[model samples]
Target: MFTLNSQSSVGHNRARTMPTSSAPRLLFLCFTLLSHFHSSVATPRHLRLSVQDIATVEAAQPARHRAKAKTTFFEVDRPLHPPRGSSGPCSTLLLSHSFALTLTKPPVTTAYSPPSCLRGAGDVSLAVLEWRADCHGVQYDRIFGVWLGGAELLRGSTAEPRPGGVTWSVHKDVTKYTSLLATGNSTLAVYLGNLIDDTYNGIYYANLTLHLYFHRKAQSAPTPAASAPADLIVPVSRSQPLDDGLWFVVQNGTDVESTRVTVPANAYRAVLEVYVSSHYSDEFWYMNTPDQNGPFREVTVQLDGDVVGAVWPFPVIYTGGINPLIWRPITSIGSFNLPTYDIELTPFLGKLLDNKEHEVGFAVTNAQNSWYVNANLHLWLDPKASTTAGGLISHDAPKLAGGINSHSLDGIDGEYRATASRNISATGWVSSSRGNITTTFAQRLNFANTNVVSKNGSEQTINQTIDAHTEVGGGGAYAHQLHHSFPLYIFLGGNGSGTSSQRLMRKVQIGFVESRSGAVAGTSTLRNEQVAEAVVVLRDDQVAGASWRMHQVYNYGASNGACYVRNVTSVGYDVLFDHDEASCGGTARR
Candidate 1:
């Protein structure tokens, strides 16, 4: 029962090699909204349940428990196989209620400027799954992910010791994914994206169960479709590929409309989902070398020349591992698995539903190589309510206020220090049921990167670097609002001498938050914050080797100033991890 809304990872277009890298304005309109739809609520009632252990193929389904009698209870358990579009058949496991081994590192994350990520169906109580290994053996990095229907639930690095003998458990208390679980039969899948099937490379044992709770008193016939009976249903315009599964080519510094929609009149809400990725694995070509990885990048959505939204991709691990270099010929250096981003265009529906042809474009910024992107947009209209409308109102492009980067090369020996600063802000007015919704989006970022390298004798080199960044940003409209600031710290410094050199990489993140008002959804409130760190140190001499540590926490509460309920997850290995790290929210991002 993981519950967080989906997390996104940085995607690169399909490229054989990493290449190189590389904005605008809007209008003003002020108008008020018309009517609204408020929500209702209740307690816990399971329609059916089964409490038997799924030890054999025949025992995979849950036992039957009828809601027919009073005082009757149900025991919800894991299913033999997860529903479709889950982790796939290759990674599912049935746990026998035993957990051992210890987590080594939390998870890596990359998020964006946000105010709120709307809620779905319900909040599920999951039997957090935590798995461990005994004498496992493997070198490459495998990314583990969980999904509900088409929406991603979570992603993390795979368990170490490539070949495992015994397995343990690390459970997740997920939030923001009730729709995928509460609805009659929702799909939940978990898998390792390392391209390995369960039958090979390692011995793994898994035990996981998701139990959903719903208020029986408020249950109604399935809710109507998002845009039915009330207004208009229009396909608008689309130029997508016949087979969207195929990647669309986009060279660096260039962008693609890939698809555009001619919005129809009376539209109440417009929803867009962008499927994107990048094609650059320069890290493999020069592991840990300066500039091996691309700078911070954002996915931009534009209406004509005016920019609307920019999203930051989560940084997940894949493509690079301790494997034979020959594998390079077959796969891109970075992960090819695609992640979709959902944008609730409710705030802009007023302008698009005008029955006129409007153009929308999707592009990637700060790209070091090619970018592949496909976009899909859907609209919901209310003929009676949305009449007073117009496009974006009072907005401007983000720019770098100032910063610096300096490097020196003395033959084979070199030293460097780098820093970058940027400021981005936009303000607009949206017509909604709550009257003229004054919406403003703003963001500021500062990054500090430093590295040192030295060559010894014939073919040996020693390198060290410290890279850190901080960001503070958020947005709002009336009583519905949120603001958060976070800092990221990473350390990669070591000396490699021939066969066995000292290698270590450590990263920490603090003060990351996602907060929203119930008013935004025309309902209740929600808040989510993240704080975590990871450590990896290995010395060929064996004296400096250390374990890993990592964690992520989601917090939800009332906007009226109340304490938040936290869903906390932690993982570690032979390392002393700190869950309560200092908050770095004060650092300037603008």
Candidate 2:
């Protein structure tokens, strides 16, 4: 007769990549939890028997004591299978009583879909039947396999492996096995039967250890592949009207609405599902700040697991301003530190409007100066909305400003325009190479031009020019009326005594000036009354292959009088219409 005693512990989601070091982390955690669950317990009561009492009982029940009272302990160890998914099958061995328990004969097995919530249930078999013969007529071993999931081991007859099924072998010392299900459901079974078909003559044991040796599965579960790239920018109007108590207009340029999200302490990344309308892959640029009206800056950006490389399409515009600073792309992983920016200093310092008719979502970060500044985001779009209205799909027109002279109303078409009317009466003097050319002249001019289209598209244009000249002779002062139309101008005339006294050779001189300005969008008022004056040099006169110093425009406007003030110095080639001499006259005087 044989009896058995056993101890049990449960486990889950073990790593199948092979075990290393001491116990697995999850395995240790599981044991720790189990220890806590079963902390208050004593050893089995049977061990309390005293020597005298044990001897008496043994003598009274000699045969039964020799067998029924025996205790057996065994351990089957291996790496745990998939915690929640089907574990591709692997090989295992069973050891008992320090003996090589050979499968005396083939075993039968029944299988079915294992229940969920159990570890590798779909990969385990329900019950298996095996038997053997010993000196005591015939012997049988009913091996039962216990699983955490839905399963019950039972006895069965001999059966062969199914097609594509994993096989289990009984080695002299170690057994090898494999699982059939590599991807989906699994089944498990153990051989169970009487120690002997000839009842009275054989031994029967209820519980025994079936050591499990883990053999790596033939194939592992395949992982999914990575995906493509995209970006989303939500725009919200922070106009005062939409600020409605619940939302604050912290910044002007944004695609988010107020009341749509809350600010979090450390929010960095935001996911956007955008469908690219064009096939162009542009370097993404966000409004680095909240000021719609700003000298905005640009910071590099990356999303959707895509590495934004050095050069990309769409020349990156920060949309928030002109003097863009720090515009670059994120090219590495560590750069994605969460909460790397502060929302308070960010353009996201506003709330979102939750209008039901629009496509809307909240933002996870404002990324101002910090790593990840959490900010709320809301957005929406409607086909019925104004096309010129700023929205995800719409292209808004550039803002328009009024011009001078003409009533501001006349320039309302929103293009750059200006008008000036002036009355001038004056007595002038001039010195030529030899003598003074004295003259007096009075004149008034009015100039205005509408439909002004600037280099960009402004509605008004203004042109003012003035020309006056005088002649000298007979050693007497005479007055000459000089008529001129231009922005501003003066003239001198006189004849020298000796002829060909000094002949100056053709000389070329170049001059340069530099200007600087903040990149604000609106028209900047003139800071000084003087304007650039330059001497005209013919296009053909510019030395071939010689580099010329060009004026550094301050915010795209020419500064008055200081640098480009000589006749030849003010010359420029009409490069677009082929090299043609274009010139102006004046001296550098700021």
Candidate 3:
């Protein structure tokens, strides 16, 4: 549980007169109480101050921003060190990214002692929390907070009150504050000070939550066709054409387009999607999420299936030629075992830097229950080579082959077996500025060898074998691992140089190896591991202030988990973050 402690200023106060807002003692008290109450089921209380609190917060005076009309009470200090690192080529790859910060007020150190106790696990748990004073009906999770406007930190209440008998209350529900925000006039006077231990301060880890609401303002009746120029483009196939100067439609067809995504380019990998309205009167018509949206996947615009391109977002756009694949079937064995299938869609051949769209077909045995079951192909961009791999023949691969793919199992049964495979060959005609048209075909592995097989719907199998004869031109390989069950142990190749450089792949493969059972009905220990690249993006869109906002995107190169934020801003925004979150039914809207 979280608590707050604030008292009148210690120093001698020089009496000063000024127009001010009242302090909220009742509300602050209520927050303290809620923090303790929510300890069991929910997280500690997120102290949200009202405008009155801001007005009354005094180091010695009533408020500082009294005369200033558009200033906030919370001081948004700049980062100790600017986030700008060595500016290399902006990547459109599906690699892990970091969203970390260095605190300035107290001067945090990188070598701080690791917590002795498991964080966010025991009595003192950590949760990413969020609270919005203005809106409602927004869902937030840790890692990502979605708010449109400014956000603030709510400190404890002030000692004095502003004009009239308007006293602020703590340890109570500040429901009245919402009304003040709706009316467009509200201030928060937080008695900013060092956070205490009893309170949520100094806790290295905590869950982030959100307090949000959505109250729609009345507007004109909706038109059947509310047409506005759309910036979002979903690609259908590799060959469909896209406009050179920004916007255009790419048709989905039987033949996927072949193109070379030259290295070192700034591009966005996104998908074109369709959403059905849930309510007729709903205001927002479409959704733009970094998490959910896709029905087609595992699509490599190559001549051969072995050379695959993975798109991050479903129907991801190809801003360049390089695209990688990040897809694997997860199998569960039990009374309700499902069929297994194989789809080898890695290798491909196409035009260089071509912009086109074409629709591909998708099928699912069960639509309502399992239609999308992550059936869509996995797409990747700007896949980096593994450092461990010694060295390879070339970065661009025409024909590729895969080997030693792993499989996951459940229920101690190889009963319900299934295997799915998809492959596309790569073959292309190339034309150069200083040469004749050349047709390139390298004997690489075809997609037929890669397979996902399970037996009797029980034991699950994943295959990554590519034939040597598959024709691929410009694609490289990457490998990475993901998390599975408990008792985790990862294996590193001898001397950490076990991967191949010529066919270099990102180390993203974590296969479950062995299981140790105990006396307790089914106690067990599992292991999984993979190595891959993690990215960190620092954006700079200079506004008229000392402080700047940073947007971080952490792509794991594969599905792992889901994420969300718990708090909201004065405006409406839900913050959330997670790994391997699937589309729709998975955690946090997938």
Candidate 4:
């Protein structure tokens, strides 16, 4: 139940933290219903279009801006391949190749219209997808989707092979969907899934491009526009599935994921795309995944109940010398850039757009375990000067009153323990045209563990821990701030005569701030950090379920930054946060 990749990203197989991890049709008929007699002595219909549908309608047109630019290849009459010797850095069409394209128009201009500005400034076009590391017998991490006229326009996570042929890129800015590309044509498709089907084993190679960067709109205001102030351009009206950008799925624990956003028709600004996918519950025993053997998983996001964002994903480490792609397509491990959990709900969007009908909900705690979500809601308006409507002027969510607080501990000739906790709090506000956008949040989670098993069975030791915290805030048209911290620890030891020990951890630290107050007020800040650590220790004597002699180590890193300061001489701010962290452990013996 995970077919995503029709095109949508701004961001699976696995043994580690399991929870969650399809075509055809065209037939036209305009019948000539039983008139068999005098009304028709001859009726013949002709409509032929194939040659791969006429080269996918001439490659879906519209990708211009050529005052003299060249580097084309989305298609040139198909049939392409050259270079199977697979040399260094790989590309020669990538040790041989495959080709197909069809995306009817989307590099706009010629006065294209449709995107009523939920926030899209420069259609400064860009599209790149290149791969050239044949990674011998690849495994997972190859999932690229770009579709059109049928939905989805860009996804992530690709480019891994680096045995010398280098060339693994993935960039997209296609003007964030210029209203699905101004006007018409969009049947372009490309999909490369993982869990390989042994296509000659560990295989993947690619190339795709679209870099227009149109620049012809600078002709009428040449040099007379330096006046210094202007931030009141209001005239927005969005509502009507807003051009399809919503997807949903939640498993086990009574699956909960609802939708109904309609506060447009003169709104004053809104943006939501909180994509969630614990790869579908990590992969089953029904939910709460990522512990094939142990360690990896930190996510937090809950809206309608508020808590906005907290993430720590990216545990892709395999430093055992050779690399058969990633050991064979399992869930590509983590963060190749297929990342999500993004939030910016404009402090509840001026009381949720004011036009009415609202209830865009989402949830992902540790209870019942099962998640796979995609939430989209983007809008912007002023209703002839935005007086800011109403909703949630006062609220508080703190009802876990009874759930998840398990306990266990004992000591005799051996010692042991296990504990858990899930804290929650949601604050509130709504009423903006000038202050009262208050939204405060709080979160706390703690889980601990220690174990030992051996009465004559030999050896084993496990230690696990996680502590999480979240803080979020919002106040009016523009002002947000978020603080997040994730802590984790895991250690695994073995023995029934076998030898091996491992340690894995995932961490996060986030700090964000945004400011605005009338006339496009300004002040933006960002600090995002991520870390992954792995330690393997083994002293094998060869042969036993599997030889063990571990001595491996890896560390991961990530960073982010942002800035803005425009409301002239004033102050503004905002914040949002969600949480999930606090997992103890027990389950790792080979």
Model number with the top lDDT: 1
Model 3 Cα shift for residue 58 (angstroms): 37
**Cα-based lDDT for every prediction:** 0.33, 0.19, 0.19, 0.31
What are the per-residue Cα lDDT tens digits for candidate 4 across 144-206?
A: 444444334444444433222223443444434434444433233444443334321345555
lDDT value, candidate 4, whole model: 0.31
TM-score of each: 0.50, 0.14, 0.21, 0.29
User: Residue 413 lDDT in model 4?
Assistant: 21
lDDT of 3: 0.19
164-186: candidate 2 lDDT, tens digit per residue: 11112221111101121211343
Runs in model 4 lying further than 4 Å from the true structure: 1-269, 272-326, 329-337, 342-347, 351-378, 382-388, 399-590
User: What is the full ranking by lDDT, best candidate first?
Assistant: 1, 4, 2, 3
Q: Identify the candidate with maximal TM-score.
A: 1
Candidate 4 matches the true fold with a TM-score of 0.29
Query: RMSD per prediction, one decimal?
Result: 17.4, 43.7, 27.8, 26.8
List ranges where model 3 is wrong by over 4 Å: 1-414, 420-422, 434-471, 474-590
- The C-alpha local distance difference test score for the whole of candidate 1 amounts to 0.33
